[model samples]
Target chain A: MSQPIDKQRRAFLATASGAAAATAVAPGVFLHAVAEAAPRDSAVSDSVRYGMLIDTSKCAEGCTDCVSACDRENGLDMLLKPEGASDQHWDMQRPRWIRQVKLKNNLTGRVTALPMMCQHCEHPPCVDVCPTGASFRRADGIVMVDRHTCIGCRYCMMACPYNARSFIHESVRLKPTATPRGKGCVESCNFCVHRLDNGGTTTACQDACQHGAIVFGDLRDPNSAVSKALAQYPSEQIRADLKLNTGVRYTDI
Target chain B: MSKIHYREWGIESPRYWGLLAVLAAIVALGGFATLYMEHEGHWVTGMTNQVVWGTPHVFAIFLIVAASGALNVASIGSVFGQKMYKPLARLSGLMAITLLVGGLIVLVLDLGQPARLIVAMTTYNFKSIFAWNIYLYVGFLAIVAVYLFTMMERKANRYSHGVGVLAFVWRLILTTGTGSIFGFIVARQGYDAAIMAPMFIIMSFAYGMALYLLVLMFTFNTDERPLGDMVVRRLKNLLGVFVAAIFYFTLVYHLTNLYGTENHAYEAFILRDGGVYTWVFWLGWVLLGMVVPMGILFHPALGAQRGAITIAALLVVLGGLSAIYVIVIGGQAFPMSMFPGYTVIESGYYDGVDGMARAYSPSLPEFLLGLGGIALALLATFVAVRLLQFLPTSLADEVVDPHLAK
Candidate 1:
């Protein structure tokens, strides 16, 4: 039987061996090369505007896989209640990055269930109202809080039209390396920027969804899946009346 | 004109120390509450993600705007060239600084990261109204300090008019900034109106004057200084005008909201359906804060009486708190409109359940914390008056009005 060699794995092995050899031969040069190679184009660029498209028509009612997955990914599940707080109270107090919302149309008598998170508006009110400049939008269109400077004033939470932001009311414990959160700062969904930095194309919610309801891609690229879907379908922003120009869009809402 | 003498409070009586000790105890209690809330996180307070700013903000903002208004008496003296008010100017400047410090302390202590206040002071987000307010607040402090100096020293008295004018204009801008904090919030339906700025300015006038009168009366009576009917009558009438102006602004604000079809829901919620908020609006803001005080101020039998004026002033202060509570807490209680026509039937988060308003009840710590701010302001005033020459020796009709002496 003829077997094909794993060429990419072989190349990786060769690179690893070469790096080890260089480290032994000249430690200083090896360190310099390693430092130069490690950055991996992490600088955010405006050329790619990351966004999401939710096909609410395909979204099933009472499906909370996306919410649970978001919790696991962001370490939101590890939030602890204060000593005497009831479980019900803690549920309301804990930070929720994403939630499955069920909306009923009064005129049409139609019901729909869709996942709601940060709309990541081009003109985010949260960013505009933040006194400390801690709530900011990346060049790539990801809105996030810089926890170090958040100051926990909760003004951003008031300014958010979608109620996307949550204040960390209690101390956090057992958080994942990818997500770092603490008490007193506002937090929201970041479109899984950690996964994107690691070269993963899909978010935890998108990956976990069984109904194929969520699509995540670069909106600036016409060839990207999100762009193509937006072009081919009629999509609606949650609060289009605000004219926030949200990066997140939904179809058949 | 007789040369007016300024004197330190100089009341070394046990009663004075006892009053100081009570105020100090209240301040200590507030400090303790702050530490407890900070250590336990915001979970201890009724403030949730929905109602981010709770009772503390109501008090902080009240004290802040009142600080600017407190300086108005001095402005009348120096800027408007009212000779009768000149003697009151020094005390006005002192109250402005002390009240501002007290208000700022409550605001800082309530922050999520109080330790990171240095970041707030240093960092600049020019687009934010809050950032502009930080500058406005600090600048007001500096201007008032200089304004105080100009009033105190004989050498600096020539520059008093210039400094007083600057401080007067600075406070108008300061109060405008305070109102704009609410006005610029485009997301909330209860706010985001152009009228908020002017309304706040008027409110500052009413609240500040009421507080100033109470302070003046308490201080003069305690020190046995000759406070006369002439000065008291002028202040009382001026306060009535301010209170009436506030009523006018509030009426116009609600009327403007009523005209807009989009604002009907908000108006209805605040005016009617909102349970505690409705009570606060009609009873606290309208009945007690406005109508009752207005009746007392304009009454044929009671308006001129000193005892009646004091009661009216106290009522106005209570009413001011009610108005602020209605604005701040009530505004947050109403849910944001995520979908205009659709109702949220189910949600993982508290999306107001069925388009209903969120519930909020002020805890003991929250009220204690708010009252602590007031105590702090009074304590500062008490100590400063005792240490420095802030109070005028006399405001007798014959002394204040030279014509009366003649």
Candidate 2:
């Protein structure tokens, strides 16, 4: 019985090896888009500083498409409000990865609308203040919190200038596989890191924006869309005096 | 001069047991509160993303600051060579250890992941002031423990001054590190200033001295040990100076912020129109915590009376808590100036609303948890006094005052 089973396994192995060998020689010919589907096995490179440029001129007020898309993509929408929790409290308590902000110029009285999220600063105060170093900026310039190490001290929340980060105030029953969230950890927008890691070119928010107000690309590459927009338009970093050298920039505010 | 004699708190009275039981019950309640908050997450309480830290921080920070301050007697006795303070040094050292332990317990338990405290201890982010504080806190405990031993053990008495000096320096650094936790956040208008470090140090001194006097008086009076007018006068006078220093720093801190055009809005919010925060600052911190207590301490008529001094000390402790509440909660209450020149009219997060001061009312559990910390500190001080010779047999004028004894 053992000999027969071993012989069957050998035959199966030969067939599997034959298919693998054929696919390797002509990759996508045998296995449809095999190389395209293959995950990035190497460390993320620092050569590309991923960034975004939001054109407030193009951003329409009352349009929450970017926020909705982010919620859907990150599974923030999946969280059920705890029973008996008030809507007012739930609004404040729920973790929001992106929020639509409508700002009126104090002097000009002109209104401007845009989506706000983590600026992903060069010198992130959150990272500097986090006792466990759970808050960190990726090599590719996407700032994120490592939930595994996050003690949920909330010093990062206090330190954030943009109010970009959110704490999981309640137990998370449901979350996306890509964005693993739980109670007792700080979290923020990571430029849709899962999408980027999976070889996707654009984020959920960038893709969802019909007006093309949000542009996501490598800021390090001058020819890239974000860099080109930054060069073309007079974009400014929010609180430019902070000198955070933020990866996210805005224009026509 | 007569040799100082130390003894355990051997009252064996029912009142003593009652006090311990009450503290124990509160500690148990605090434990329950922590479990409830931890199980339900912070949402069950009033804490939201907007106000991540709530009452627990107020208690923890107050206790920790007071812990550093509690060592004043020992430092005065050993380091500053105040012979009058030498008799009270042992209790001072003990109170410091207990208060810190109690405060740290509340702080660790309040964490989003209390079980992950090991990670906090093991992980080191040197640049982070919080990471440095773990060392400062732990080192404070160790250094104070050694200092206690030098004072307690007969042969080690010779090294008491050396260890006392080390403990004194470590505590100053400890308090500084604690202040730096808030001060280092450069963007927050309330805490960005470097004055916070020195301000906290001065605060610790006042808060610490108040607690020290209260404990010393209570313990001595209960046990029928005479705490002299000389010791009382010295400590109370020291407390007055500290309270006045706090006043000076408060003035300077506010004035500095007021001078800066950028900080005008924040200053206004804190000083005039921050609603509850403003009330807590002026009424709780300034009026009751400082002015009234200072009046009681410095008034020639009231200053000599033990009951009046006790009341003043209690006021100082209460005021210290108010000051900490304002610093921790009120500081976070003010919204971050995300759009410096633009008013955020609408946002999913409550930005630029309610005079830009976010709502934060301390819930029942949070309040209970904070009270539990104070009880724990007192309970430990009680137990340690009973079990060990932490108090002098007597602190009569002739016993304590070198001039009189001679």
Candidate 3:
């Protein structure tokens, strides 16, 4: 399936007539124009389902560029170690949006390295188990936690198959404008929603990967980079047995 | 038949005052601990990204499960028509309400954002088992209270049996909801079994009965009232049977898990090489909790003695706690196998490195918070018994059992 090919039309109309002409267009079409034109305050639509494709064979071992980029983008790196907390304890307690994972086949002894984060499943267990409906999936298929409503019972953390979600243990003093994190709320990868909302076409991790291993685009659009990569390469979800229909796809691992 | 007369605990001795003081102190300490944890965040506790639920959950779940089973005494008298158990029915309903309140307090206080509990109450995802549990716990308190009222009021006594039956069914549903909280989680190897629901039901029967017996003995003895051998003997025997049922379910749960090729690693972790968890399972749950208690409860000489029976009951309580610990903490300790056939060689996250169990040591704040829940339950029971006519005047063989009276 492809999105209605109107980027050129919207881009031309945005430049020629600006906001006044946009009001005459239908809401769906106007939002599409807003998304294309990099408007800061545009409602996300289901017309595009964002996803990612990771080529694990091309992902270099010991490379933490994607992980570091995610930390910076989400303001996770801004968190400081609480008073008297040991390094070992801090490592386990801290929130992580994404992390590098190296896997070895038990029998074949094949070593594969890739970045692990939220799979953004069509059927997310975390979303189903949240008692207050704090964990929700956006219309564009991004799963995120509503920190304001989160009671921080950690039931979502328990239900997550990917172990991708993290609970912010101690109080957070500093955070980026894009992300508002606090103690006691469960959080995970939202595929750079701030970047997407600002009309940026790429994720922090995808931009940081020097090897061009990470592809980020709308999966529903057949012509998008992610869809093209998924069709070209043999890719699989981390836990395919659960049939979660994950948006994040991996190859050669 | 002589009518059973109810009375409040009247003798305000130094021991009674001392007991109340101690319970209050512990409850205060628990409140302080909760504040400390809240201020510092959960980082102060043993819980981490891997093991989210910790000691508080163990205490909360045990009390909640036992709260349901505590009502079984009343269910026997009112629903099953056991005349011998009718005298203890008031205390049974009271204990049910108190224990549930205590457990729910712990559950709410232990949340990462405890201040936002109102959000949990107002907004709900009905699909979640946690949300269903909110209703179950509240309904249990309400139903048990109404059941208690029906039992105590002479004019309302006729409706006691009908209310008792409803309370009985509601407790069953409550336990089922509690069990389904873990059972419904398909992500973990340790959980996701349909058997968890029924296993938890049996567990409630065992744990609840054990605590009820202890409370009965303590209260009756303190009041200098007559408690008969016939009633105690019957309770001990029932406790023994409940212990045996727990064993059967534990065996079935493991046997089923062992049969699944995918579950083999998890089974081995809990049964064999998982150092702390394995010992807790064998020694804490099986040895001290079950085997020792069963031995004392079944022996003709030991089972007949009140002291021996109390020891057995205490052991059951300890065992029940251990069983919950093994289920909650141990289950979480074992990492979810993200890549079924591959070993996670390296990762920033633990990722069950080298297939080892994640470390979790319960913190002081969490432990105190848990004890606070226990203390709160005991204090409530004590105050309720003293202020209200929850205890019957006598449980003598002649008074309780009509055959013995003749």
Candidate 4:
């Protein structure tokens, strides 16, 4: 149950990076950029590396508590609904850090609710393509972007196959709330950094996921629901063939 | 034996001061707008989640493609046996370099973080086509600068002919790479078409000729140096061929998209049923950008009229720029969904994707940034010609010494 120190450090760096970078997400968080799950240090044993198992079938209808809580906790100043013309800044134009997607299968004629957030992919194209080394994914499988180092070229926007990154475009007249919005940078979903720091398992979507549709835990551990869900039920990843090795997975209704 | 005194090769009296003044005023205003955009966030442009990359990108790409095309005459005259094109050679070279620089400036200004543009280059994203494009474009611009510089060198011990030729060859590859950026994306409905890259190349040549013709007219008005009819005809023919090729590509691209089993949502909206963009693609692009211009130039009779030729060139340039605008802007204007049935907003009023999503309209600030790029281009052109002697000062040098090898 042990490994080399360097490997451990790398794991810590990866998750920390993912969390850090996710902290900078602009256009409401997207599920992307999380590397493999592994134990970083032994003292952190029984850490129960947490994640959410989102049952798309029964996510709450329109209560965006998860989304708003995430914004409030992260200090993202997101909007469920923008106030006026100038109030709409690129970072949180319509802050649904955790929002339910109403997916309708064209062929099957079946509809389902799927809560979308940062997938924290194992092979994140955003991280791979980040020119400034600004984008990073964690060992615990979380994705994040560092706003301080982010020069804002937005190549990441184009690189993302999932269409996640949003440019903090010139909102000159916009009087932003003292939250995290900044000009000349790219931002997107960071699975609630404050909640994570407080030893909370990604609170936004999970707590609001009233039907107990959301499961968060370490997939690497067999005891974890995420692992149990994968082991028991048929699951799917977004654009799976892309080989992004995404952390987020969905099960049937 | 004395050489044939064909014509002078420098920009003399040009009273286009009115145009310059107006543009200068606009450029200053644009600079102010740029400052504002930088100060705030991207609330200036109309781009939203639905319409991410907008008009500025289209214009940036168009200008770059046109800039690349402007190099062809140089290639033809140097690579082939077209002697008449020699007089305007330097002008075309100068314009190509200028326009390329101009395109890059606008592209950089449009970035959410302009300073971080270099980061993409330094960081390699093999999966992302855009990453490769940024690198290739920079490479293209570098080579072009060298090529233009080489051509500008004085005949005595000049060392840029080979350099210029090398740059010309690289330009083609660079443009092809640019095309692939869009062409290779199979997922995006309107973009999955592979012919997009070649179509871009052909379109560039059209823009190149259109721009060259426009430059010639400007010169004529100022009496800097009048171009011979033979040379102008070559320009016309070059444009005609390019227009025809682009038209061929466009027809095939759409027809294939429709003919195939793949249910394309984007192209279907644009080429077949979409409202405003359909007109843009069909008439503005197919009819105006391609067909009419092709008709005007392809006809032997119309080719004889310099005035008519000029008109054709004008249409070709207009249509080409518009085509890119329509493809980039209009492409996004349409809703995006791989599936159908659930009240799909099938392009009625660019009401944008998802009722919650917003539409893109280039704000005054956005427009200013775009103009600033153009101004930067003009300024670069003026400085290049002034200092490096990029313009042909003597027609004697045009034929006097082909090789600068002491």
Candidate 3 root-mean-square deviation in Å? 9.2
Better of 1 and 4 by DockQ: 1
lDDT of 1 at B140: 94
- Model 4 Cα lDDT, one tens digit per residue, A1-253: 8765798889999999998787878324343322112222223333334455677666655556666655565555532222335544343343334544565555565766556666777777677656566777665666777776677665555445555555554442333343356566666665554455445655665665568787877877898767888788787776676677777777773
Model 2, B32-144: lDDT tens digits are 99999999988887888888789999999999999999998899999999787888899999999999998999998888899999999998788899999999999999999
True contacts kept of 2: 0.79
Q: Is candidate 2 or candidate 4 better by DockQ?
A: 2
lDDT of 2 at B155: 96
lDDT per residue for candidate 2 within A166-218, as digits (tens), equals: 99888998888999998989899999999898888899999999999999999
Name the TM-score of chain A in model 4. Answer: 0.67
DockQ of 3: 0.63
Per model, the share of native interface contacts recovered reads: 0.79, 0.79, 0.86, 0.32
The per-residue C-alpha lDDT of model 1 at residue B58 equals 90
Query: What lDDT does candidate 1 reach at residue B104?
Result: 88
lDDT of 3 by residue, B1-406 (tens): 4789999986567988999999999999999999999999999999999999999999999999999999999999999998889998999999999999999999999999999999999999998999999999999898889999998888999999999999999999999999998998888989989999999999999999999999999999988899989889999999999998998999999999999999999999999988899999989888888899999999989999999999999999999999999999999999898999999989889988778788899999999999999999999999999999999999889988777877
Using Cα atoms with residue i matched to residue i, what is each candidate's TM-score against the true structure?
A: 0.94, 0.94, 0.94, 0.80
Model 3 iRMS (Å) reads 0.7
